[model samples]
Target: MKKTYLLLTALIVFSYTAIAQAVPAAAKMNQFIDQLMQKMTLDEKIGQLNLLTPGGGIPTGAVVSTDVEAKIKNGQVGGLFGVIGAEKVLQAQRLAVEKSRLHIPLIFGSDVIHGHKTTFPIPLGLACSWDTILIKQTARAAAEEATADGLSWAFSPMVDICRDPRWGRIAEGAGEDPFLGSAIAAAMVRGYQSNNLRQDNTVMACVKHFALYGAAEGGRDYNTVDMSRIRMYNDYLPPYKAAIDAGAGSVMSSFNVIDDIPATGNRWLLTDLLRNQWNFNGFVVSDYTSVNEMEAHGLGNLQQVSALALKAGLDMDMVGEGFLTTLKKSLQEGKITMRDINNACRRVLEAKYKLGLFENPYRNVSTERAATTILSPDKLALSRKAAAKACVLLKNDKTILPLQHTGTIALVGPLADSRRNMLGTWSVSGDWHHAVTLKEGMENVAGQQVKIVYAKGANISDDSLFNKKVNVFGPEIEMGPATSDVMIQEAVAAALQADVVVAALGEAADMSGESSSRADIGLPESPQRLLTALVHTG
Candidate 1:
């Protein structure tokens, strides 16, 4: 009994020592942020809650903020995405630290979803390997490249658990199981941020579309999601909690309603659950214009919804001027307290502080460093290995996959040589020109001993309206000058000349990402007809 008492006393002492050792770093961060916030004006404090994007990269929303340079100089911006390259990032950072009144360093971010410049398989594909280590490595590689290009934050590891394949964004997450989703979420956070946010090669991971976005009614993007609290806790919320617990620096609120309230304005969710219950210390940012989107959700006008979001614990507004335009008015109107605004601003500043931005704002912004680091040979090799591991062989009929290099092979489809679709979805920073298509890969692997005949079997879809919708980001689906019938004939002619036919068919990249849910998730009519023609030719 005496020994037990001594052991327990020793354990308590050790725990106290560990806590004592850890508190100073955190206390220092708090102290620094407190001092910085004191120097900021009301407009500057409000500006720290606004996240905007310049029009250089893909705009997920309709509006990209104009006068971005002016905003940064005026201290009306917190962070910027859509801007790539180290030189460009350095220029933006200079505007904030050199020109802004408080000279708070700006945090640059991007959607480094799967892999950065060195693109890998989509998240869903990576999840299929069920190898968390490999998944983590992919994220680590992405962080390395992203940081080299001067990005400090990655909006990644979309952990939404989706059972419905019709939901286009399912490709962006681990598949239907919450257990797997939770595991992958933790791995991703660890990979991106690791044990240190101050590390030059690390990036702050943002676990996104928080709280049951995958449960949208009818599998529609940004649609209503109605579910009981028990169901949400059991099926949908575990992955988010896992990410937060794993040290994700930020969370992005989903554009869905919980308990009939938009998530951006749900205090019970962002605060009561994420903060008080889960003990998540990170900040929360809304999805693209999600704060303003709440107005469309019938909550209120832009000003009212922005106020509700701030009071509910949303730290930063993404590409929406709601918080930038209306938070001051709300504070003046007594709709929200000054403490609320300060809390959000402090959280944003804390992220920058943790990133060691105050010590050296130019930590990752070096063109010389970027030239050697982004898409390095080792990273490209890792991407190749990841892609191979992610390939799921649904079936092997007659052991045909291990094809002989001596045979004439027919590689026929719109996707056969399509580089644009190779990287899949949400790969904003990936250059499709750098992507290796199936034909190119086959020729390289099969060598000159094999004669490879290729044909564009069909346009991805013959439906003009469907093509138009998928082509929003660019021409993912290009209706060729040749008719569908002519395309099928060409594919059949190629197939007849080959010993074996390899038909590559699937949805366009845009057909399976944000705002792209499909009611009938199947092969498009054009691909279906081409497949039929090829089979009938036998």
Candidate 2:
């Protein structure tokens, strides 16, 4: 017993020694950033706070930054998203380090939400599994693929806790349990960033839509979110705090109004709650044009709102150009202090330093690595395994699910043969061509012994306006030439011939992400009509 006690004391001492050893490394990093900041001019420092996206990937907002190349060369840009491919990233980094005056490196970022190239199930779907280890692995795989493509930052781990099914963005987050949501949030952060941001394969994780974004009024996108502080701390704020505690490298301010002030410009929320109360050391960035959108929220004009956001602890402005265009003038007018600008600039530069961009700007850029690493066999296999686990089995009447191998099966739905919606939403980098459809998967598993018939039971929706909205990124909902009645009859005909019928129906990929909120959370008219017909035929 004495010997055992001595050994336990030794272990505790060793742990303290290891922690003490890490303090010098932290001090050294601070010194380096301090030296770098001393050399930066006001304009150059403000440049570090602007994050832009070149026009290639999907733009979540109305404006994509113009003259991106010229801005990078002129030391007017800090980081960029939507710049895909290792080759392009190398070129962009070269422009920043070689052509710019300060020779500062640019950080590359992307919305690598679920999976990068090897697409996994959406976050909400993955949450159904309640397997935190599998969720972490998915995030790690996403980071590996993203970094191989020259991205150092991933704007993901959308940990907003939502109870409203009508909100389209609910699909982007874990469901409405704070304890489970907090666990998933920490797992994601650990997966993406791991224990080291300097590692080439790990990308920095950004916990997004901070505070109470998911509790938007009426389940609408970017709507007002007003909740009591008690409710916020008890029900809604746990996941965001959990992600921060897990060492998420950054946070994105939501577009909602919390307590009658825009989150981007709310000093109480961003400064007091995030930094003071919670001790979150990472920087804060605004959601897409959220700083500028505060003008529309009746806060102020572009300049006023930009100054307000800067003073409120928002370190970076994403795609708004509010910081780039108006910050210098705001500084001149004494509307915002140089210390505010300097503090924000230091945070942004500190993130770049942590990413090791200053030491090696091209650390993550390699065409060969990207080719070998993305969508590899192991990743695809993991994706398949995750998909299987994510599927929830609520009921199996008469043991219908374990379908006989030699029976005739009728698979009828718009989604059965649709590969476009397979990966779900926010998979900006996923290739739908590689996605296996439901019919193909069933055939592969059932083999030649089973006979299967498929039909596009109906269009996802008969509403033209809704379809148009869902198809913003691409053709998610394709309207076929056949009428609704004709399609329903065709599905009924297929069901009549088969011994068992399987109907695959749900929201299209875009129907539950970003701007795709629904007023009525029910099946669309077309799919509902088809399901009724199938029931009648039985």
Candidate 3:
């Protein structure tokens, strides 16, 4: 194992060496950046500080930027998120590269959290396997598919440490152990970046939710996090540091505040600690509209918060356009210096340079490759194997676990045959139609000898309000017209006819991701009702 780890490290180093040989060295890169900055206007520099989303993935606000193409042409848009497809990405890239004055290539980024096309087990579940190599391989596959789809960056490797199950975003992180979480964080960074940011198969890894986001009081999403600096250093900060140490190219500021100030505008967290103390050289991006949301936190209005965030070492503003629209006025008013804007723009451009975007703006983006790479047979098979290994067996007495493949089995629950929920949360690019249902898997393995019965035991939740919340981003929990009692009866009938009953009951896919927190982190009432009926039927 030690030898394998050493070889992995050596290979990553070689990848980096190969990139250096192809691109300019540090001194030369600096000189090139200096020359580029001299040619850029004030508006163009501030544009590089702005990051926008084009209404494809999760939307945090009502508007989805109708003028994105015009903004790109005017050199007012820096980069884009939530946009996929080689043709669509190529269209957007052309506006920046061909129509804009500087013709600076835009960096396309997305939340390729798990598998981009081939969905793997969730990060929390992947950590349960305790296989760092498997976790790294999953990340590598995600990066490949993302780059094939014309993305140069991934906002992934969420390393927040969370012990509270009530925290919805807990599904995205590697559980509560700082030691294990740090290890996973490093492995994910190494996998995503893979020692070559310029490589087509690799994408710049953004280690996210920086500075105690998981420590939100009461386990509420976007809630305040108050902790002593000692507690922060010892517990919550290690994973972020580990990711940075593993050469992550970007860091995302958490939405929650730290020590009475929001992380986006907190110099102590972003600059004094991350940059000065820990020596993280990567640029920092705000969570979606988090910089603008500071107004509600009583920090200031749009202009005040934008200047505060820029001065606090925030390099990229995601979705808010606070930096794009307000930074120029703030500069004229002397609230921020040209040096600060130049520094932020320089970092953003430097990331693009490292990504080889400056050399070949359309590096590795081919329609044919995009069509063949995503959801390939090999990737799908790996995902199935990963799913089997990640699931922990609670008990298996007398080795009765691996039942003979020739028996009648009943698979019961809302989740048993649901394709949409299979990919889990944050799998934005995963196609649910291709997911293998439990019933299909059972039938395939049984080889027509065993009869597999399936039933929708219950809806994800009986409460209408909860269903609305979970389905905000997508159809996470779909409710049918049948009554709960009818569904329970159907499930019990199936269970009675089978030799063994498998109840697949849990929260819906959206119930555990961002902005989907629950006060009671248990099976919903409908599932509990279904389980009780099944127990009585037996």
Taken over the whole model, the C-alpha lDDT of each candidate is 0.91, 0.92, 0.88
Model 2 Cα displacement at 187 (Å)?
A: 0.3
| Model 1 bad stretches (over 4 Å) | 1-17
Summing lDDT over every window of 10 consecutive residues in candidate 2, give the lowest-scoring window.
Answer: 54-63
lDDT of 2: 0.92
Expressed as tens digits, the lDDT of each residue in 1-538 for candidate 3 is 9999999999999999989875668777889889999999898899898888778655355547668888999988889987888898888898899999999999999888888988999999999998889899999988889999999899989999987779988999999999999999999999999977888899999989987889988999888788887888889889999999999999999899887889999998899998998888778999888899899999889999999999999999988989988998998899999989988999999999889998998985789998889888888878988898899999986786786787788889998888778888877888888887777777777876788888998998988887898888778788899999988888988999998888988977888888878899988889998988888876
What lDDT score goes with residue 435 in model 2? 93
lDDT of 2 at 448: 76
List model 1 lDDT by residue over 195-295, tens digit each. Answer: 88899999999998888999988888888899988889999999998998899999999999998999999999999999999998889999998999898
Q: What would the per-residue lDDT of candidate 2 be over residues 1-538, giving only the tens digit for each residue?
A: 9999999999999999988988887888899989988988888999999999877856488779999989998888989988988999999999999999889999898998899988999999999999999999999999999999999999999999998989988998998999999999999999999999999999999998887899998999888898898899999999999999999999999988888999999999999999999998889989999999999988889999999999999999999999999999999999999999989988988899899999899999999999899999999999999999999999998888788899799999999999999999999899999999999989999977899988898999988997898888889999999999999889999999999989999888888888778899899989999999998987
Q: Rank all candidate structures by their lDDT, best first, as comma-separated numbers.
A: 2, 1, 3
- Which model is ahead, 1 or 2, in terms of lDDT? 2
Between prediction 2 and prediction 3, the one with superior TM-score is: 2
Evaluated with lDDT, which candidate comes out highest?
A: 2
TM-score, structure 3 vs. true: 0.94
Instruction: Kindly report which residue stretches of model 2 are placed more than 4 angstroms away from their true locations once superposed.
Output: 1-4
